[model samples]
Target: MTTLTIRRPDDWHVHFRDGAVLEAVLPHTSKDFGRAIVMPNLVPPVVTTADAEAYRRRILSALPDGHDFRPLMTLYLTETTDADDVEKGFRDGLISAVKLYPAGATTNSQSGVRDVARVYPVLERMAEIGLPLCVHGEVTDPDIDIFDREAVFIERVLAPVRQRFPALRIVMEHVTTKDGVDYVRSQAENTAATITVHHLIINRNAILAGGIRPHYYCLPVAKRESHRLALVEAATSGDARFFLGTDSAPHPTHLKEAACGCAGVFSSINAMACLAEVFEAAGAMDRLEGFTSLNGPAFYRMEPNTAEVTLVRRPEPVAYPATVPFDGGAITVFDPIFPIHWECVPAR
Candidate 1:
């Protein structure tokens, strides 16, 4: 129970912001993950094949030497997106999927699709070409409560999309509610969900228990304790429908602690160690590989990594950096609020 080894894992969701931030944070994810589906929500966004190609190149260049990491690029889905261009990207292997961020849903999503119907042509084309659509999965209606947005999105937006394009593949990213888990299960054949490390470990209390703890804040904001337990059960159940997507977003420490802070948690540095603690605590240690390594590739129609990564538990807690320096500022790392004893390293 103290030692565990599994195939090298892939982060199904991550954000490596451009320039200085990208350079500072890319190493943490690349260190432990064999591949990562890099998010396209950035300034000017990666909305075309050319953009994805350029972004992929930048990610590769930023990667530290000796790490064989692949950045699986995705196009930011906008209402004006070109269907032909999307098909070409998937056909040429430059892009793995298309990201659907409901306009105003999260950071840098102002250019996202506002009217779903306007993008039917693109969605139909993606379905025809077998390309998956990764969604933020929250409705941005001003009247809807933040906690209820994910559930409302399923009823008002996602369900209709699913009913219309039954063949299109979908990944509900960073699912935070039981409603999301149940919906993904209902559409089991062509649908799956990616659970983040922070959502599995913390609830809304992490952000609002006594006073606002801005560092724990994130989009699709963590739900209640009951929802966290649902996420735990689903992840540890060894179901192929649920897998790891850390959503390891980084914001400058000053920005995170400000009056109006950014929404993200940078956990790429200790994600596996935190996951080991979670799985072990749930008494589902044996199924950790499926959640972290095997199932994601199966869902994405890719091969699992042949290499192995080992996590060793020690008597004392492992030390993880509190913040990573970036351009004279720093980005805060997520604190799971619990001690982690496991340390992960690539198997030689």
Candidate 2:
């Protein structure tokens, strides 16, 4: 098809960091996505409703003029996270979900809960209140292979939680392996998964192939090709349980190009364009709306956007910058490794 239009989409996962970083990247997302489940793993992390509220204001302040984006804030779940505060945030509409980072699963996760049992009370309360727990879904044990963490997390941690609180809604964020997809399918009733544009497009080879391309690196890091195919199947299947969450995390280019690089893919700038190319490759263009716009709000128990966004395939490839400026510096944009012909905008 030359053109496609769907409800303005929401990103169930995103990280618009604080300060200058947040300001530089907020527009990339706000330009197209109607709303996003803003991640709370900043330096201090948003551990309370007040923190989320303050952060939300900062996000609003940074948004470009005429942009109608809403940041759906989240609390970084911790052993000390107050169940009452969590429930209050959910009820008051200040927070969309609570994130469990597994104490070193990803960036700024040192304060994450180390022991799942320590937060059983909080988990039980969330289940009771129907608040969804968005998990990073990777075990950070020193002995486990990096590639095996997500699978191990499913077997060791997530499975028990599922059994204990069958009613709790859970979203396995940026799922990178087939194991994750299978587990989510198994829970069919109250479980779902968010796939990233980076994961759907690249594999470990993109990072370590000809050389160590640090920009391609990310947490739960990209897995093998078979796993990528599995994610593609889940996303393009039009399954309600599978939806879009770009996980469009941005780390400064200096940090990413360092000896010990950070983990994230800054795709907010080109997410819809990349997703259009991905869905087109799968020959599941018809299901793109279900993955990007429809399923996420359904899982979040919110209404689909009243507005629509249109993406048109241009005759020539759309030109996108290699880097987006930030202060005097810049962060490299994600290279989709494919020609991008689609340009997304509000559907008039």
Clashing residue pairs in all predictions, respectively, total 0, 0
- Summed over model 1, clashes come to 0
Off by over 4 Å in 2: none
lDDT of 2 by residue, 137-160 (tens): 999999999999999999999999
lDDT of 1 by residue, 1-348 (tens): 889999999999999999999999999999999999999998999999999999899999999999989999999999899999999999999889999999999999999989999999999999998999999999999999999999999999999999999999999999999999999988856899999999999999989989999999999899999999999999999889999999999999899899899999999999999999999999999999999999999989999999999999989999899999988699999899999999998886
Runs in model 1 deviating more than 4 A are none
TM-score of every model versus the real structure: 0.99, 0.99
Candidate RMSDs in Å, in order, are 0.6, 0.8
Residue 62's lDDT in candidate 2: 94
- The deviation in Å at residue 283 for candidate 2 is 1.0
Give the whole-model CA lDDT for all candidates, comma-separated: 0.95, 0.93
Report residue 68 deviation for candidate 2 (angstroms).
1.0
